[model samples]
Target: MSQQPPAQQQSHPGETGQMQPRPRDEMADYTGRDLLADKKALVSGGDSGIGRAVCAAFAKEGADVAIGYLSEDSDAEHTAELVRRQNRRSLQIRGDVADEQHCHDMVDKTVREFGRIDVLVVHAATQEPVSDFTELSTEQLRRTYEVNVFGAFWTVRAAAPHLAPDASIVITGSVNGLRGNKTLIDYATSKAAVHNLTYSLAQHYMQDGIRVNCVAPGPVWTPLIPSTLGEEKVEGFGEQAPMGRAADPDEIAPSYVFFASNRLSSYYTGEVLAPTGGEIQAG
Candidate 1:
């Protein structure tokens, strides 16, 4: 297992370079078998962390990529470089996924550049920890839900028309969604909604030959951890996991690739794959 340093905090919407023990998001050693040959993919929050890894993985599998993020131009450019290194076209779209118009624009720009979208990975999310449930403010709750829940809805809806048959939709859920988290109340609730949305959308689009699925991960060493969880929680981040350490973004990425590839997950729809360091939860 990989080792992570003690906790370090950053401002909201953290940068990957600012993170200590930088997350292994490059997908360096992964080899692909053209599972997504010539496919076009749009990934929200694709600038860093799990999204960055997923973009690289998709590119390695022969898919061109379009990344949408709030700002993070540098990180987005870097991710695009990685995709280009794999000889795939990369389009970088900057805007907040929480904005409905921005979501529509993201889809329009991506489709214009890539011709079509074969995979849509809604990985962008935001969270603010409230030490106590009562400490959660109305604004914080709304912001969290806006980005984590509604953002997914707006993004998917905007992209839905452009997605062709056999297209795949992958949503990033969390272990916190399956079971409540005392500290991450708003974040957990949003993710829970996303999980159910994945199920509902799977049924809604099944007739169109579209597949929807989710990957609910446990503690992952991403910029989101320190940025949202704070110093103390970051220090021993994944110790509670049976694996004793948070997973690297590189480690969590393959689950996305699996769901994105029809050759691998043809019969799977509305499924939640938990890569949670041995943590178990009932359905």
Candidate 2:
């Protein structure tokens, strides 16, 4: 993929088909080695972007997947088709992850379809940029936390009972969570909470033989960029990174794959694999 310039989308939660230059989110060229053979997985926000890539990768790795999305029926259907093409069962569930009941229902539905969950990828997130801290409203902050932080909590809690031994849970974090972004105060804060949640859950679940980890990515060219950052910011979206370009979802999905496959990451737990395009940060 080539470098992308500033692009704008009129809607929040932008459609993948409308993205210019298109995000490399389908993982079309990725080949799997059956690392997750016969596993059952659940991916939140699996309709597009990182979630879509992860679902495809998991399917290619031989895991049947259940995808949870807010709406985006077309995207969801398309993703399901992609999984089916890989010869894996794909279940699509639609609802707001911020709703605790919806989270429980999603887990129940997945269990009903797949019998058990061997991997859980909590990848659904929402963000709205604020130029200054003062411009961030109470409602906006609440919504951000609800979707980015609380949603992960609800889904994990609801799925905990049904998770098989050695199950892997991967949460999506952000570079902004590690280093504050001036324009994304609320979103950064919410993701920071998710980062800590991953650590805490790792410790709490270790006794159950479940491993929890996080992938904190730098700027990635996903729908969230144009829909949230608007035209000016989107043009130079990832120039600040050492790579000078936002990562494709294709570039990030492998981290989830590594974490999901116990064969690959059995000894890893409570770790945040930061794929920030060489933007170094202090621990």
Candidate 3:
């Protein structure tokens, strides 16, 4: 567990280097058991934070990772380097997830690099807090849904044909979706839709021997927090959780590894795993 982050903020789409008490997003001490040996994966939002950690962990597990990002060229390059250091191939595909065409392009590019995609991690998302529900703008609402909801739908739809049997699709959901948030109204709603999407897609893809699951994390120490939340909220970030601290990217990544590895989670489908720092909630 990590201590609470200091009061800090960054411009949108924050960078890892600019963060104080730099996040443990590299999975440096983790050792892979080849659970994903030779598998090919495409991760949206693979540039920083949980996405970066997932890419690193996937590499260690012997998967060639294709990273998809918006801009953050430097961070994406660094993540690709981490995957390459594992002696696995890494491809960086940069674009905005909010665009339907870009979502399809991400899959096409990944398939081109790796021949086929065995795992698809839908992780790109954006959120902005609003002081009052009435103050939420239509633009923010649309942006939130476009990236978090529509992007997930479009990317998975495009990758469906390329995915082979026994493929795994993991979606990133949020604790806010399970229990709504006051400030993050639209973001929470978008995530709720994503959670439902997981269930629907799981059923839709089961006939093809594919598995779909979700990881709805609680407050985690990632670039998203400092970039979107106010400084006052950042200071005590995860204090509300029973753990009294935010999780490092390293901590939350094993959940993805578990879901991705057929050896571990073959029977699991349409499941939601909440790594919420001991914050218990009913289904």
Give me the candidate number with maximum lDDT: 3
Write model 2 residue lDDT over 75-119, tens digit each, in one string.
899999999999999999999998999999999999999999999
lDDT digits (tens) for residues 1-283 of candidate 1: 3675686998878889998788899999999999999999999999999999999999999999999988898989999999999999999999998788999999999999988899999999998888888999999998999899999999999999999799999999999999989999999999999999999999999999999999999988887888787688889889899988889999999999999999999999999999999997886
The list of candidate 2 runs beyond 4 A from truth reads: none
Candidates by lDDT, descending order: 3, 1, 2
Q: Candidate 1: which stretches are off by over 4 Å?
A: none
lDDT of 1 at 101: 92
Point out the higher-scoring one by lDDT: 1 or 2: 1
- lDDT measured at residue 93 in model 1 versus the true structure, 0 to 100: 94
TM-score of 1: 0.98
How do the residues 48-137 of candidate 3 rate in per-residue lDDT, one tens digit apiece? 999999999999999999999989999999999999999999999999999999999999999999999999999999999999999999
Task: Give the C-alpha miss distance for residue 38 in model 1, angstroms.
Answer: 0.2
What is the alpha-carbon RMSD of candidate 1 to the true structure?
A: 0.8
> What local distance difference test score does each model get?
0.93, 0.92, 0.95
Determine which window of 10 residues in candidate 3 has minimal summed lDDT. Answer: 1-10
What number of backbone clashes does candidate 1 have, counting pairs of residues 3 or more apart or in separate chains? Answer: 1
lDDT of 3: 0.95
